[model samples]
Target: MVHAETVAGRRTGSPWLPFAVRRLLGLVAIFVALLVVSFLIVQLIPGDPAAGLAGADADLADIARVRHQLGLDQPLGQRFSDYVGGVLSGDLGTSFMYRQPVLTIIDNRLPFTATIALSAITIVLLVAIPLGMLIGVLTQGGRRRWLDTGFGFVTGLLDSVPGYVMATFLVVMFALGIGLLPLFPPAYTPRFGSASFVLPVAAIVIGPICTVSRVVRRETAVVLGNDYLRTARGWRLPAWKRYVKWALPNLLTSTLTVSGLVLTGLIGGAVVIESVFALPGLGSGIIKAILDRDYPVIQAMVIVIGMIAALINLLVDILLGLIDERTLGGSHVST
Candidate 1:
């Protein structure tokens, strides 16, 4: 009979299964750590949840009663155990300010946050990838030094600007200065196909485009300089054909890795951009929850965002494994 280890050593059914299981375990560990840290950090914030619940003018007795009612009077160890257990059981607790379930609040705001994140990623990939490839190809050919310098300078400038600052500038330029679009209406109520999405999406895309393009350009340059690509050139292949058929496929591994990071950054950046645009998203909700010392809402948002980042990275890993079999513990497959 064949042993399991021998079967694993040979190019058997699916090498990816073991790697995927390991990655899943790692993700679960990260999620647990995130919850513990989030809970502890929120607890460390300097404020009384009881007071927030009871109001400033409330009598001492009222505050005491509120504390007891919310289980704030419980021992720290007990409270933590309860919190972790509740999270594992799909009970995120109720929002202190909204007096509603934390899950319900998140469910309502999730679509808006998701829309912004997704739209920004779509814009980044569509715009940055081609632009970066073109720039890389041009620079590799030793043409357009001035154009490369200009692009480098602009991307550098954009990288330095924060999301809110960029959002403000876009609003000033397009909405206020040009009188081209209505900023308030869209900021207040952003719709998928509406014009209001323009400014917000632009703001979210700016930094990522600069960052991802630079990475893609560098990677593309490296791919273009490879010996095989030189061999392809020795055959007198057309430039476009070489790039499309040879350079791009080789460049995808690195570009895809960078895309995962860009996706995570976009999610984080959306919080600030969403606030600046006055968009009704998790970012604004998180801000309000913090100011109000609403621990449930804050904890829930942190968990959701952390999960998103983890999932994106995980998906990128799986895709990388598929593209390059060596990543799944097998021999490298030729491109």
Candidate 2:
């Protein structure tokens, strides 16, 4: 998967040092941008935040006091500076609605979101990699051509379905379109090993499994056609060595790249899934915070989610570098 042009750009200094420094610098830059954007975006929302939160009971002076309390009376630059200073000192401020520290609320809700995301991703990797390789091997050279067409059709259809739509459909079909659930329990809890998890997890995994599997399947087909693989066959190598040693490594590279993207999408996509299932995950929590104009909660969740997304992409690059340093390019790499 390493591009040819990158080879000429490689540094002669040290092997991984230059690459690691460059990546860490880029990560820090991304984090700064994430903080600025997350903190500022809520200020752009329409209406007076102080007045809205103060509600009908408060008079004009009460609203002004509320604005002062929130630093809304200050200049935009001054407010932003204070916000950054507070965050750097590890204070996310208090939630307007919850009347508690923002970090405390997030810590309380983190496990629910973590459970769904982790469960869904683990299932996707387990199912997609094997299914993809099997289909690739079976349909090679146009043998069993019908499997290719069917596989493409099915994966495309499954992947196109949104998480909310899938969640709703699953509930209706499997839950008998009623309040009662037959095959699975009604809701999710952190009480591990709950049968209630089955439906929500199934909803989350459908699209990701289809996406990662298709990438693997296509990569496998390409690797199978490689000259080195053909040469291995000519030498009468064992099937395990020919396929496992030669074919699977390339599959891992592509699979890891696509898996990272799918994970980022999962963080965003969990909102609708959480809504449908009435789960108290970060996704659903953000929706509530937005509606209530809870700035601390909103900003903190955005920072947390952005950090997760950035970290995932960074880890993927590191893995790609491990496979071959050339994949990470050099100092003057293209965007």
TM per model? Answer: 0.90, 0.88
Expressed as tens digits, the lDDT of each residue in 50-139 for candidate 1 is: 997898799989999999988889998998899999999999999888789999999888888888888888889888888899899889
lDDT minimum window of 10 residues, candidate 1: 326-335
**Candidate 1 ranges beyond 4 A from true positions:** 1-13, 184-190, 329-335
Model 2's TM-score against the true structure: 0.88
In angstroms, give how far residue 319 of model 1 lies from its true place: 2.1
The number of the candidate with the highest lDDT is 1
282-302: candidate 2 lDDT, tens digit per residue: 988988888888888999998
Clashing residue pairs in candidate 1, if any? none
Query: Which number leads on TM-score?
Result: 1
> All candidates' lDDT scores?
0.85, 0.84
